[model samples]
Target: MLEISIKPEVLGYIGAFPLTNAQLTSWLSSLLLIVVAIVVGVNYKKLPSGLQSIIEMVYEFFQSMAEDAMGAFGRRFVPLAMTFFLFIVVSNWLGVVPGVGSLVSIHDPAKAVSAGIIPFGAPAVMAEAPPSADATVEEQHAYVPVFRGGNADLNTTLALAIIAQVIIHAMGIRTAGLAHHLAHFKNPLEIVTELSKILTFGFRLFGNVFAGEVLLTVMGSLVVVLTGKLAPALPFGLVGGAIAIPFVMLELFVGAIQALVFAMLVLSFLSLFVKTDQSASHH
Candidate 1:
C-alpha cells in the first residue's frame, strides 16, 4: 500500500482555512486540467491531432452516454455531466501510476541520513526523503506522499457524491419547484426517516468507487508479491507492464462507468423527487 504524509500547510489556505489533502488534490487536478484544456484548445482544428483528437473522442462518447441516460433532454446537462465524468476518470487512473506508491517525504532533514541517530544539537530543517528505504541502510527515513487518487480518498468521493446529489436537487427544483422539492422531507412522519435516505444516494456512489480502489490495491499487492519470488521473467518491466495493461484499461472503463452510474442515479433520484412532489400537490 502507498502511504504518503503531507503537511497540511503545503496546500494553500481557503479564505484562512487550510485545505485537506483531498481538497488540494482536487485543486491541483482542476489546475492541471485547465492547463491541458488551454493547450488543447489552442490547437483545436477541423482535423484534430494528438491530444485534441483524444479529448474530442472522450467528449463525444460522454455526450452519447449522457443522452442515452437522460434522453434528448439530457443533452442540456452534458457539459456539467461530461466534465465531472472526465475529471473523475482521469483522477482514478492516476492512482495506478508507478510513482503513486513510491512518492514520500522526510519530516526531518538531518535525522533522515544521520548515522543511526541524529546529533542532540542538530539543527532542524526539512529534508528530502526517499520513497522507499533499504533495511540494511540506516538513517534513511522513508517518505510517503500525502496525496493519493482523489477517488481513492473517501472524502473526495463523498464530496463528489454530495455535489452530484445537490445538482440533482437543483435540477429537479428548476424543473419542478421549490415547494415541491422541500416537501420531500416535510410530509414524512419524522425528518429522521427522510434524512436517512439522503445518505443512501451519496453512500452508494462512495461505496462503488471506494470498492474499486480497494480491489485495485489488493490486486496490485498480490501481483507484486507473487511476481517477486515465483517468476523473475514475469516481473520483467515489459512483461509486468503488459500484465498491468489490462487493469489500466479496466480502470478506464470503470471510471467512465462509475461516473455514468453516479449521474444516472442522480437523475433517477430527481425523477423520484419530482414524482413525490407531484403526488403531494394532488393530495
Candidate 2:
C-alpha cells in the first residue's frame, strides 16, 4: 500500500518557520553546490586539469548554447541559465538516490490523528495500530519520510518560476527603457500572457518531477508486495533490483532534459523581449 500525499511533510521547525522534508532536501542541494563551487575556485589553474577541465567544458558548452540563442547579449545571461540548469538537474537526480525515501520520522499517533494531518482513510501502516496494553499511551507510532526531491515540491518549483520571471522582466526593462517595456503591457492580452507564464513555468517542472516521484514510489511498493508473497525467505530489495534499475536510468535522463528545457526557455524569453526592444529602437 502506498501513502501518497500532495503536501510536503513537516519534519520540524526553525524558530517561527516550519521546515518541510522537501525544503530540507533543497537546503542540502544548495549546500552541496556551494561546496563544489568553493572547491573549484580554490583549485583554479592557468592550465585546466581534472575537475577544473570538466568545469571549463561544461561552462563553455552552456556559454556556446546561450550565444547561439541570443548572440552577444546572451553572454550576460549565461550565469543565470547555467545556475538553473545545474541546480535543477542535481536536485532531481538526488531524489533517486538510495535511502532518500526510506528514512522516516516517527510521531505520536494520537497527536498526529488529532491534528487532522492524516486523511480520514489512510493506510493503517502510516499511523500504526493502536497502542498495546503494555505500551505507553504517548508512544510515537506514525512514520513519515524524512526527505523528498526538491523539485517534487510545488513551493520550490513555483519559487524558481517566479525568480526566472522577475529576471526576465528586469532584463527587458534594462534593455528597453521602463516606459517602452510598460507600453507593451498596454494591451490587456499581453498582461494575461505574462501571468500565464507563471503557471506554465511552475507547473511544467512541478508536475513532471512530482509525477515521477509518485510513479517510482508506487512501482517499488508493488515490487515489494509481490516479492514478499511469492518468496517469504527472499529479500524484496534483491528481487526488485532488476525492475528498479531501468526507471532510475530513465529518471536521470528526464532530469537532465528538464533542466535543459527550462534554461533554454528562459534564454528564449529574454531574447524575445530584447529583440522586440531592438526593433522598436530602430523605428
Candidate 3:
C-alpha cells in the first residue's frame, strides 16, 4: 500500500509540543551539521587544502557576495545567509537518504484512519468514509513512515520565509528609514505585496520538495506494481528498488538548486536595498 501525506503527521508529543515527522528530520539535519562543524572546526587549519580548500573557496564566494551586497551590513548577513543555505541544503538532501522514508510504524488501520494518520479508500487515492470497527483483517494494519523531508512541510518553509522577511523588512527600515518603511502600510496593496513575499518564499520551497517526495513515492510504487508478477513470492509492491535511482539523483540535484536559489534570492533582495541606500546617500 502507498501512503502520501501532504501535511506532516504528528508522531507524538513532548510536554506541550507537537512533534511532526518533518520537524524531527529538520532537527536531525541541524544536529548532523552541528556535529560535522564541530569536527571540522577542531581540525580546521588557517591554510586551506584539498576538501578544506574547496569549502573555504565556497564560503569566500558567499561571504564576498554578502559583503558586496550589504556593504556595512554584509559581514552580519554572512552568518544568516550561510546558515540558511547549509540547513536547507542538508534538509533537502536528507529526504533521499535511505531509511528516512522506508521505516514505518505499525498501527491499527481503524485507529490510523480515525486519527487522520492514514486516509480513506483502498490504497487511498480517493477520499471516502472511515472504516467501521468490524473492518476487514487486511484493512486493520497501517505502515506510517516516521521521517519525512523537512522542507516538504508548509510550516517549516513558512517559518524560514517569515525569518527571511523579518530581515528583509528590517533592511528596508534601516536603509530607507522608519518613516519610509512604515509608509508601506499606508497602501493596502503595499501591505499585500509585503505579505506576498513571505508566501512566495514559503510556497516555492514547499511545493518543490513536496512534489519531489510525491513523485518518488508514486514512481517507486508503480515500479513495484509492474514487477510484482515476475517475482510473485516477494511482497506485492515491495521488490523493485533499483528503478528509483535516477529519480533520487534528480531529487538531489533539485535539492541543491533549490537551496542555492533560495540563498541567491535573499542576497538579491538585500542587494537592491543596499543599492537604493547608496544611491540615496550619494544624492
Candidate 4:
C-alpha cells in the first residue's frame, strides 16, 4: 500500500512543544550556529577562501545592517545582532530541507501500531512496511525522531525573544546606569510605555516567523493536493516545487531581517537611554 501521508502527524508532534514553530526553529538554529562557530574558528586563516568568503560576506552584511540601523557605534552591537541573524536564518531555512516532516517512522495500521517512548503513539501517517504480519507484537514501541526541523516549535522563538529582552535590558543598564534602567518601570506612566515595548517585541517576532511557517505549510499542502488537478495545465509538481523554492529563500532573508530588526530595535531603545544618561550627567 502507498505510505500513508505523515506530514500532518509529524507537524502535530512538533506542535506538542510549549512554544510555536518559530521558537523551536530558533533553538535548532542556535545549535546549528554553535556548530558553525566551531567550524569557522577551527578553519580560521589569514587569507579567506570559499567557505571563509561566505562567512566574510555574512559578517559584512551584518556590519552594514548594524551601521544602517544603529549608526557609527553600531559595531558595539554587531556580535549580538549577527548571531541572532545567522541563527534565525538557519532555523528558517532548515524547515525546507528534504524529508523534514514526511520521512519519519510511524505506526502501521494494517500491521500493528506501536507507542513511542514519549508516552504518545506515533502518528502512523507513513509506513515502511505494513508491520510483519507473521508475529505477535507489543502495544507500544520506541520510535526514533525521524522528521525534525528548527522553526517548527514556538519554544525556540520565545527563547530568542527572552534572550533579546535580557540583552537589551542589560545593555541599557550598562549604558544608562541601574537607576535609569529601572526608570522604565517607574510610575504608571512608564509602565504603559515599557509594557508596550515588551509586547511589540514579542508579538512582532512571533507573528512574522509563525506566519511564514504557516504560509509555507499551506502552500506545501496545496501543491500536494492540487498537483494532480493542475497537472495537465502545467508541470504542476515542478511548478509547485519552483514556487515553494522562492518562499524558502524568502524565509532565509526574512529570518535575517527579523533578527536584525529585533536587535536594532533593542539597540535603538538602549541608545535612547544613553542620550538621557549623558544629559543627566551634564546636570
Candidate 5:
C-alpha cells in the first residue's frame, strides 16, 4: 500500500515525547554539520583550499549579504544565518537522496498494534516485501520507513519560524532598547505584521518541501504503474527511476533556493528591527 502521511511517522520515544522520522533527519543533519565543522577546524590553514575553500566561499557570500543589509553589526549575525541555511539545505537534499525513503523496516501488523505504532484500521504497507509471502503473511507485515524529509513535517518548520522570530525580536530589543522596541509593537498593525511573519516563514517552507515529497512519491508510483502495464518484464524500477531524474534535479535546486530564502528572510527581519537602533546612533 502507498502511504502518504501528512504527519511524520513516529520512530520511537524519549520519555513521553515521540521521536518522529523528521526529527531524526534533523538530528542527522545537525550531527553531519558538527562533524564537518570539527574536521575543518582541526585542519585550519592559512590559505583556503578544497572543503575549506568551499566553506569560506559560502560563508563569505552570506557575510557580505548580512553586512550589506545591517552594516558591520550584520557580520555578527552571519553565523546564525549560515546555520539556518546549511541545516535546511542539507535536510531538503537528504529527502531526495535514494534510500532515505526507499529503505524500510517490516512490522507485523499485530505486533505494530500492540506496540502502539499503528492502529488496527490502518492498511498495511510494504516497501519491498519478498515474493512467496502469502496474502495472510502480507496482511501481517507493514512498512515503516526509517527516514523522511525534515521540513516536510510542520513541527520542524514551525519550530524554525518560532525560533527565528524570537531571536529577531530579541535582537531588536537588545539593539534598540526594550522601551523602543516595545513602542513599535504598540501599533496594532505592527503587532499583526510581526505575528504574521511566523506563519509565512513556517508554512512557506513546509508547503514547498511537503509538496515536493508528494510529487516525487506520486510521480514514481505513476511511472511504475505505466511501465509495468506498457512493457511486462521491463523492470518498472528502472523506468520509474529514469522518469524521476529530472524532478529530483529540480528538487535539488528548489531545496537550495528555499534554504536561501529562509535564511534571507531571517536576516531581513533582523535588519528591519536592528536598523532602528543603527539609524538612531547615526543621528
Candidate 6:
C-alpha cells in the first residue's frame, strides 16, 4: 500500500536529536555537491574538457543570468544562487528514482490505517501484527526511508526561505543603512508582507515536490493493484513501472524548473532591495 506522509518520518535518533529521512537526504545531497566541488577544484585546467567543460558551462550560464538580473551586484550573489539551484534540482530529481520511497514500513499499523496512510488490509502483510486487546502497542515502529527528496519536506523549504530572506535583509541593511531598511517596515502591512514570504516560499516548493512524490507512489500502486487483479501470476507493478517512465522524465524537467525558479526569485528579491538602496542613496 502507498503511504503519503506530510511530515518526514523519524528514522532514528542521534543522542537527544531525532534524525529524519528528509534530513538524511539533505545531508547526502550536500555531500554530493561537496564531492563534486572538490573534484572540479582539483582537476581545473586552463582548457576545460569533459566534466570540467560542463561545469564551466553551468557556472557561466548562472553567472550571466545573475549579472543580467542585478548588474554588478549580482556577481557577488552568483555562488549562493547557484548553490541553491544545483542542490535543489539534484535533490528533487533524486526523489523520482526507484527505491527512494519504497524502503518504508508501517510505523503504527492501527494509526496508519485509521489515518488512511495505509490500506486496512496492509496489516495482513506487515511484519508485525497489531497488539492484542490487552497488549500495549509500541509507541514507535520502524518507518524509515533510505532516501527522500529534501524539497518535499516543509522543514527544508522553510529553512531555505528563511535563510534567503535573512540574506536579503542583511544586504539591504548593508547597502542602505539599518535605519533606512527599517523605515520600509514602519508600515505594519509591509512587515506582514515580508513575514508572509516564509510561508509562500516554503509551501510553494514543498507542495510541488511533495505532490510529485505522492503522484508517483499512487501511480505505481495502481499499477501493482491492476496487474495483480488481471494476472495474478504476473510480476507485481512491472506494467506500472513501464508506464511511469514518461512521468519520471517529466519529474526531471519539473525538478530543474523548480530549482531555476527558486534561484531566480532569490535574485529578483535581492535586486529589489538593491534598487531600493540605490534610490535612497540618490537622496
Give TM per candidate.
0.63, 0.82, 0.79, 0.64, 0.84, 0.82
Candidate 6 or 4, higher TM-score:
6
Instruction: Please report the TM-score between candidate 2 and the true structure.
Output: 0.82
- lDDT values of the candidates? 0.57, 0.77, 0.74, 0.58, 0.80, 0.76
lDDT of 6 by residue, 1-283 (tens): 4557788866655544556778988898899889988898899899998888987887888889878877666788889889889889979987887877765556656755443333333433233433345443334543546478888899999999999899988988887778878887887998888898878988888988998888777666675555444332245458667777777887888888989988888888887675443344545
lDDT of 4 at 149: 46
Query: lDDT by residue for model 4 over 124-160, one digit each (tens)?
Result: 4432222346433223322323544453444455566
| Best-matching candidate per TM-score | 5
Q: Largest lDDT belongs to which candidate?
A: 5
Candidate 3 deviant stretches above 4 angstroms = 71-73, 109-141, 183-187, 227-239, 274-283
CA displacement after TM-score superposition, residue 213 of candidate 2 (Å): 0.9
Winner on TM-score (3 vs 5)? 5
**What CA root-mean-square deviation does each model show from the true structure?**
8.7, 7.7, 7.4, 8.8, 7.9, 6.1
- Write down the worst ten-residue block by lDDT for model 3: 124-133
Report the lDDT tens digits of candidate 5 across residue range 157-221: 99999999999999988988898788887869998998999999999999999999888876766
Name the lDDT value of residue 133 in candidate 4: 61
RMSD of 5: 7.9
Query: TM-score of model 1 relative to the true fold?
Result: 0.63
Instruction: Give the Å error, residue 233, model 2.
Output: 7.2
Model 2: CA > 4 A from native: 108-141, 225-234, 275-283
Cα error, candidate 4, residue 91 (Å) = 0.5
Model 5 scores a C-alpha lDDT of: 0.80
Question: Superposing every Cα of model 1 onto the true structure, what RMSD results?
Answer: 8.7
Better of 3 and 6 by TM-score: 6
Alpha-carbon runs more than 4 Å astray in model 5: 109-141, 227-234, 276-278, 281-283
Predicted structure 4: lDDT? 0.58
lDDT of 2: 0.77
